[model samples]
Target chain A: MATTAKSRMLTGSKAMVEAIDQEMERDPRVFVMGEDVGKYGGIFGSTTGLFEKYGPTRILDTPISETAFIGAAIGAAMEGMRPIVELMFVDFFGVCMDQIYNQMAKIHYMSGGHVKVPLVLMTAVGGGYNDAAQHSQTLYATFAHLPGMKVVAPTFPDDLKGMMIAAIREDNPVILMFHKGLQGLGWMDQLDASIGEVPQEPYTVPLGRSRIVREGNDVTIVGIQMMTVHAMKAAEQLKEAGIDAEVIDLRSLVPLDRETILRSVAKTHRLLVVDEDYQSYGMSAEIAATVAEAGLYDLEAPIRRLAIPDVPIPYSDPLENFVLPNAEKIAEAAKALVNM
Target chain B: MATAEIVKEIPVEKARWMYETMVKIRYYEECMVQAYAEGKTPIFNIGAGTVPGEMHLAAGQEPAAVGMMAHLTENDTVTAPHRPHHHAIAKGVNLKRMTAEIFGRQSGLGKGKGGHMHLFDPKVKFACSGIIASGLPPAAGAALAAKMQGKNWVAVAFVGEGGANAGAFHETLNLAALWKLPLIVVVEDNHYGISVPKEASTAVPFNDIRGVAYGMPGFRVKDNDPLEMYRVSAKAVARARQGEGPSLIEIETYRYLGHFQGDPEVYRPKDEEAQLRKKDPIPRMRNWLLEQGLASEEEIAGMEARAHQEVDEAYAYARESAYPQPEEALADLFEPA
Candidate 1:
């Protein structure tokens, strides 16, 4: 929310495009290839202006062949090319799960350090505009369950730009899941924190890092991607009631910043994990398990996780809203934790 | 147009090299089969903890492997199917390392992680997939990189006739041709996919002709002959290298053994294997070598002995090599953060 003259105000999608543009300009081997990435400028606007800037060779548009294109990205990466490929939606992973999980994810590790797959698989995630079950999944946990790649979800423009650059420069495969609500698309409802001042100069936000957006002493609320925005809002409301709520935005999931989470929980001694992914065996469960295993003594109350119940995301707006965790739900969970 | 009788003049040196490669592949597979059987005593179990997993031996498919591989260079890449040993050897993968990998040793191509069906050798730009026709997409990817980088290198994908019926195969071929990528898709028609006959599984009479739907030239090299296989493969490879886009070349070959080490092969008609053995590419190639005066009887025997010796040495090395430690299984899941 900083309005200083020195910083450039950019939307999350624009920042992502700039990060990719900078990386592609720096390394000739780095290129973007995926469906609708060229003429359409990316359906989510994440690749806006990249086609006109880089031309056809670098900003290649592909057919709707996920198995072929994603598999091709793996082959190209094996041949010393740094390719940034976008899967249109994380929900569509079912069509080409073998290519992503078996080949792209397992190749580097199976090669016994002899080979490296420096590829970035970017996909759109989350649901709030009634995009339905197919288009509205935050399935980064599904990817993180497999042991090969890094999964990142950024809640703000600055974090998106920095993470995009870092993911492109990384030698291992990284999955960058952008929540639809945080893209600052004008047609869609935009969160105030989605658009912010970003550094014009290209930089990398280190992977496996967490940001404490709000610090407090009473409780620690862990969130990622769209859920982080709701948690921060809940914190603002809790402040009026004199209940101190700490909010943490988990930027990366694979090499999870457990130390930061543990440190915050040690101080607050009350935890509420919020995730857009489903409840059972998900990011929420993993975070809760981490706290219970390592920071058991610091817990002043039982850990609470507000996540989607085990059900497919529905297309109906009210039904979808009922399933998704929101600021109200998060604040209620926090109040319970504080009261306990 | 009538099927013109295509006559291709072969150089003596090239013919000699092809013969040598075919012999080497035959000997290597024979050794692996024997080694695999040695661990399976009177029981004859597929999973008796010797070679451990299913081994799909490519005994009678030498012509397709050597012929298509002869046009490849170190810079060029290839993706192979479940039956990949012949392709691996023909593609210039280190034999010692490949054998050790088959034995699950620590010094193998994937350090014992990938085993035989999933071998990946960066030196030779070789990779394989256990899934049917899954190799086509990755091969197209390598070709994509070559086209983007403006390199003359080509990538080859090897799939069986049954695999050619897969959706991925058709999709990849279409993409390669549409993008004008430097790729050659070789369909080795081996008559059977495990227990299912190619006739029952494949819709098209000729898998190569399926390329017409994708606007690419298609050719079928018939009769189990390596020289003919080479002529067709060289043309397809040249088409890819010249930026004429991808081509489909199907080589009619056969696998000498069952689908896997322990497959009963009840689906096949009686004595079908024995009948197909009559058209084995190895002896046919040997006869051509003698008729063309490319090698004397004594020199040919010497070459065969050398191949056997090479395979014997590889077998010994694999036997002596130590297996990867159990704790090492936890490693290589990802690059250290």
Candidate 2:
């Protein structure tokens, strides 16, 4: 809504760091801690120019100890310090899940409201540039399945900044997952939509909310994180093919905005859920279930889902792209549903 | 390098407290072994029991916990590994709540949310993780918090010798040393990590010497002697309290039980456990206490009886407590906004 002709356009990475910087300046208790988050400015550029401004006390370049640093973030948060800890990649959660899920997620609940952990766990997700099974994964569904943690993924620069500020200010632990493909990094093929006009002042887009990026009535196409970008493109393609599609970006997964999704299905009477995470028991399924339970009478056709199959994301570009949801896949799925 | 002499004498009251705590931990673990066996008599179904999960009993590792914890106060913090009962008991965690948690009762420490391996008692600043070597960083973080807040409070992390090889262990040591955090890393070298011996898993023979690589003084307690552990930890605790950074201490301890309650322990030699039992730290400390004139036999017997009574009361409390409601599973997942 702040976008204007004179507004400055920023990349997703710069917008994320700008939000963190503004918040750090606002609150002395806030700090950054993670591997390569200092001098390297984060492997994905999430913390660029922060270390030089904040110094070592604020911008801590930690060793490659995901378990220790992340766990330490939880400890610091419990002590009333707001720490923005990075896990480098979402695929590496396996090494430090105890600290993330068992400790960070459960400490507030385990303490029975006596202890409150206010921290933002930022991590890079998704893969398109042949990083293989280990480096490339968007395990958003895995974190959402577990209780006690708020999970969010932003598509554009503005939402990334607002949601990040909102995450840093939240009382509970929040996992801010950013996709690599949408980060606008120089090495990877970036999306033009990933760069957007961001407000200079710090703002917070509330969590647990969904945004209607494109509105139509023929079919409802819901996407999460990076898939939202693809859905917007697919909506354009569907228009050219004589079909009107509605695109919804689900920013938060834990407190899923089921009402917005149900309303879209009601108007469209057809549904297509797109996700970059695994197919089974993921966001796609959850969206389908949401529509089936509350908006079953509104649908004229069965909900179709486009996502990665239940297999390790291969290193080959063709294999990886084959499984990943894209504009073509979303457009195809929406056309099929509309025809039905 | 010269070895530090064990010249500092532990006070009579402190020695007695350690003895009683060690006795209490031994009895509690012994009781757990029995409690874990209930309802699984005909066939060993791990999921079908009063304590329905894998139970790791720290029966022979009491000295490592009591020695280090004796130097800590309630304000200090402790993060422990999967085998954490001795550490929790030594750190003054409430007995009734811990037992109820192990029994998955509603009155438990975590309200039956965290079981034996995942016990967390913030009142005494005690927490443990089921993952190996996972608690080290949090301990360092707590120490960092203490330093940042200008508190003299120190934090201790307990891990197994096998866990010493984990990346979390090394990373935390570096962080603690670099930041000058009041942290002490204690490794209970129980000779075996589950089924694999230390030789097979660890690159070095002693984890203590690895501290030198991280610019911290490391000491190895040769035998599982409570007095020796106390002597080594005294220096580390004093150093940490003095703002002299972290220290690593590895105590050569013994594990009497299998890795878990149901572990067959096929990899262990038949006579290995029996050999380790001959040098049990409990009786060794009892004899040392009597020889040093720190406690009388009557006092020792009284302490042992008191420990048994406490364990009995805790078990009763756990058994009498009720299970949480079935729908309560959805509760506690998130804090109410």
Candidate 3:
């Protein structure tokens, strides 16, 4: 919990900006463009001090045009510019999906490898602030379901910094979705696990790799982004109940870390996939299918998934909390899986 | 700035092609209405038809599609909204394959992966989305691609007047103007966004005026006249091809059918459809072509028969084609590595 000389404690947003800054300084082609990315320094603080450092040319402030700018990012990328465009909210993918899915995601393949779109589409995701249905969604499955793009959600500052650098460096389009609750913002509820010691130097966390945050012999609890933070908390709660729960952070969804998941499920007889995305046809179902496909015999108990029921995230505090996956709900599901 | 005299400037061959395209689009929609009603006769169960799901036929909006598409080449890109059959036909999408896709057959455009609303024909550089106003940004991207590659090819996005209220519309307009991309946004003002009239949903009477705020020229084509559409879109297309930037054109179009097949007419006025039918663009265009001495009555009748035959063959092809294998639904989500 304490910061040492080798590493300093950074919030998820600061770590993300640090990686972007380092990348911009390193590559002249690398730049940031989005709504409020300049002067305002990103409403979520993802681009905080970079605007002062990079100025208007590099850190361009766009006119809230997710489709045009995002599409322009694809055009620029095709023309040999590595643009790091931000979609203010993952929920806003609705307005610009044709650009995201049809253009950005498929242009490379559609062009038969003749073109490469190496743009990083970073966006704020997750629900907990009572922002309601329109604003609050972690639609990981929506992007992951489409084949062309890579989807990553990093919870801690270390992985946030490292994976962001990796996403920027990757040749394909990478969707870097960060959880709002995990960003360590002053206005929203913060997660302690989101604040961690991150090295100042640039590093790359390989995409498609899953990390086992906690090792246990009894049950496997799989999560991504904010759910990983919840899963870790649930692990602690289960530990007190004498249930050893293994927590796996699935940083990337498209090139899913199925091997780590299968390996973990093979070790622990029970599996519980927790997600903040919709329950049906989402991350939970995909993870469940992965285990069922190859690691079915390893499960001693039926695989359980805890996710938001197929409903829009509501506005009121009680309603939003009721639908979202928290430590309590995750602990309950893990406990039930262990008992079963 | 296209006046009535500009309508005369349209080449006779182009005018004839536009009329034939409108006729073909109307016949296609009419055939689809019958095809969609096949199994749902007495009970009217929406899920019972061969075309199973919701069907939104663009019967009365042919002029807008042919007007803007008349300027486009095979290399130019088009991104259309959900009610896209008219645009698809006018843009030269293969009718049989598109119909087969609509019928959920294996040989369809997306190989049955994408149904009616999600048709993607890369050969002609045409794609459409089911979501409203979502196509504008991608169309801009296509235009941006052309500009960056130093090509004269422009991209056109066809959206409903209802879609103009979406943030994507404003965003795309501003972005396209700022970047000086060769893009055209055509708003087919069909008066209703699924029963909510434009007055209730839009702050402005006309969406074209919004283009002025975005620093682009905006034009409105009155009364769904195909010739007028051709005239106004000609200027817009010329400006875009010259790298002058994007333009917005709003066509006062009409939707003759319900928003979707099987949608009860509870929200519509009793006499609206009948009144709209009185000024059907297809018949009006036919009369205009005859009066202009551009085509003989026999030529117009021949065009009508040919259009009907094309629709007939497409429907038959769709009916005879095999549905995609159930397991094959999992394919085409991503291209192969």
Candidate 4:
């Protein structure tokens, strides 16, 4: 876009790693820690070379004692340090929920809001990695349900860089989730480790802004993380049939851009939300219920949602295909909502 | 920090002071129990328990408080477990205000919000906690802060025998050992954690062995004599103040009163409680002091009477203090998030 000649591709996680590495070189307090974060370059290699650059104290290699290390991070943050703690997988947040929900979120409020713990808890969430039931679950619903925390999941590489840098700078505690299945979906990563196409320098995209990736008016389709990729593909399919549909990427959940969603819905008049998590009472319901409560008269038709049914996300090709909402399901749902 | 011995035995004046303090604690607790039966206090105790008559191990645990605090300079921090009243007195947390705190008066440490075990006087380095084993890492954090700021200060954490089983205790010890933090962990093993025996709670025979596992030098002092706890704690204080990291002093003592005011004597065996009482550090150390001509019986008696008088005055002061205004309950509720 900036008249670049050598634009390339990269994975979202790899982009995050490069951004963190470059930031670590620039700043002193920005360091990473977790199981195998150092030496092992992180479990999924999300933190490669972080340990080598910073020694054990700065780039600590903690034991599997999540509660202790997380508590230690809280203390460290209070005592002036910006630690980027990796949860390995986000589902394990349940293990140290007390430190996350009780301490990290409430410390500032309890200290009469005198304390500011600038910390980032980065983790991989979502299913389809065959991470089984425990590791594959998406608990953003639990985090977003709470008031004090902010949640961000980026679908593209440039977005990851922007969100992460913002998360690091944010005075409040932020949870930046990278779904395991959407690692390299965008051309932000190349087969080689270089971030050739990503914006050369670091920058921040303000939280709670929805990027309207495609312009249309017939139906408004909302997608999150990996689901956004599918929603765009489905919008392309809808265009061939002359059914113009708007594709909105809901980038964040906590500081959710509801005003943006309402603006799109006012023009489109129909809403179709596609989520990879379970369909029952998930993000889809949250959005649908809020829209209904806020602008019941703005809707020309009932909102439609595409999500995995109220069941464990299946791993088999056919079963997973049947349960999960994809481009085909998004198009079908959008067609039904527009037709209504 | 150097682990050198205190270099001299307990002098006569200090022995009398220690004996009188212990006696005062014992008598004051017994008096509070009597007052409770006479309708002096309400049921809403500060530490999620009863009022008055609720003291535990105050008789045997004084020397650890006195000795551990003697070495601290102005900038050091100290965190205490539930039975923290002794530490409060030893560290100069205004006895009248502390007494007011325990009685749930408006002039209390947390302005009546936190009571008994929750004393929080930030002006002094003294803070209190009711959650068992919750104070370790923060204490280590203070020591880390002292190190970072280039100050010659240390932090001390005191807990009971059973608290060593908590993950907080173990992790703090490991981290202190790893960083060689200037801290002293005084394990006031008064034979029991509330009503559960230490043997029932821990697989390890003694807390000293557990301390050894964390790679710190441990002292299993048979502090059946209060003077011995003072002597051992002096060495620990020296080591910590000199920046030699933490040392664990397991003072094997006993509690004479019931766990709390209302707890019946059903859990403790009759003979077991009697055996522990016989080994109570107060009288044993008293007789030792008298035998060694360190304190005359009159001197010890006078100290005991003075401690009781002090307690009586504290009770009077706490009673006269006005109740906190209703709106004060919501005050200091949030710092600002």
Best by TM-score: 1
lDDT of each: 0.88, 0.89, 0.86, 0.71
Predicted candidate 4 versus true structure: per-residue lDDT over B128-218, tens digit per residue: 5666766666566566656555556777788888888887788778877776777778788876778788889989888877767878888
lDDT of 2 by residue, A116-138 (tens): 78999999999778998999899
The per-prediction tally of clashing pairs is 0, 0, 0, 15
Candidate 1 chain B: minimum summed lDDT over ten consecutive residues — where? Answer: B1-10
Ranking by TM-score: 1, 2, 4, 3
Q: Per-residue lDDT for A239-315 in model 4, tens only?
A: 99889988888889878888888888889888888887878767899999978988678899998888878887666
Model 1 TM-score, 2 decimals: 0.97
Who is ahead in DockQ, 1 or 2? 1
Go through the candidates in order and give each one's DockQ: 0.63, 0.43, 0.15, 0.18
Where in model 2 is the C-alpha error above 4 Å?
A1-10, A106-116, A127-136, A181-192, A240-242, A278-281, A309-324, B1-7, B42-44, B262-275
- Which candidate number maximizes lDDT? 2
For each prediction in turn, the share of the native Cα contacts (below 8 Å between chains A and B) that it retains comes to 0.59, 0.53, 0.25, 0.10
Task: Work out the iRMS of candidate 3.
Answer: 4.9
Compose the digit string of candidate 3's lDDT tens values, residues B71-99. 78998889899899999999999899899
Q: Which ranges in model 3 have alpha carbons more than 4 Å from their true place?
A: A1-32, A38-60, A65-84, A89-120, A124-150, A155-174, A178-206, A212-247, A268-340, B1-8, B199-204, B264-275, B290-293, B296-306
Q: In what order do the candidates fall by DockQ, top score first?
A: 1, 2, 4, 3
Q: What is the TM-score of chain B alone in each candidate?
A: 0.96, 0.97, 0.97, 0.87
| Lowest-sum lDDT 10-residue window in model 3 chain B | B1-10
lDDT, residue B155, model 3: 87
Off by over 4 Å in 1: A1-6, B1-7
When summed lDDT is taken over every stretch of 10 residues in candidate 4 chain B, the lowest stretch is B46-55
The candidate that achieves the highest DockQ relative to the unseen native structure? 1
Worst 10 residues of 2 chain B by lDDT: B1-10
